[model samples]
Target: MGLLLLLPIVFVSNALVPTQRMTPWLRDLTTWNPISAVTAAARELLGNPNPAASIDAWPMQHPVHATPIWSSDY
Candidate 1:
């Protein structure tokens, strides 16, 4: 579920932002926005504070590093 939110952000950041003309605020959103939908869904499904188990391999460079919140520990 968390991966779902990350998907769009990652797509926009890596694909759209480079070629498109977006405002600074919009660019900021693209960079920092959290995937609320995915987070909520994960919370519902996992019933835990941590949603790391819900992430998959595609969007994450290293699936093992993917967590509910961004972490440099990865």
Candidate 2:
């Protein structure tokens, strides 16, 4: 669809453009739709240096069943 093609265009254009001028449009785009175009832009900007790398190697807190206890549950 035409709209699908626009997503990548919007993402690349926003990423290549100066942040100042692009900020408004980027913000509006992200707020208007959390997925697709806006999401792509965000990933291009904030994603790790090696975007191709898998997230399994990334540092993150462990097992879902394990919860840290700072104090007694009471």
Tell me, by TM-score, which candidate is best.
Answer: 1
Query: What stretches of model 1 exceed 4 Å from their correct place?
Result: 31-71
- Tell me the tens digit of each residue's lDDT in model 2 across 1-74: 99997677556432344333446556445323323223333454565332212222111111111112211275
The residue pairs in collision within model 1 are none
Runs of candidate 2 with Cα error greater than 4 angstroms are 1-22, 36-74
Residue 6 CA error for candidate 2 (Å)?
6.6
Question: All candidates' lDDT scores?
Answer: 0.41, 0.34
TM-score of each prediction: 0.30, 0.21
The candidate 1 region of ten consecutive residues with least summed lDDT is 57-66
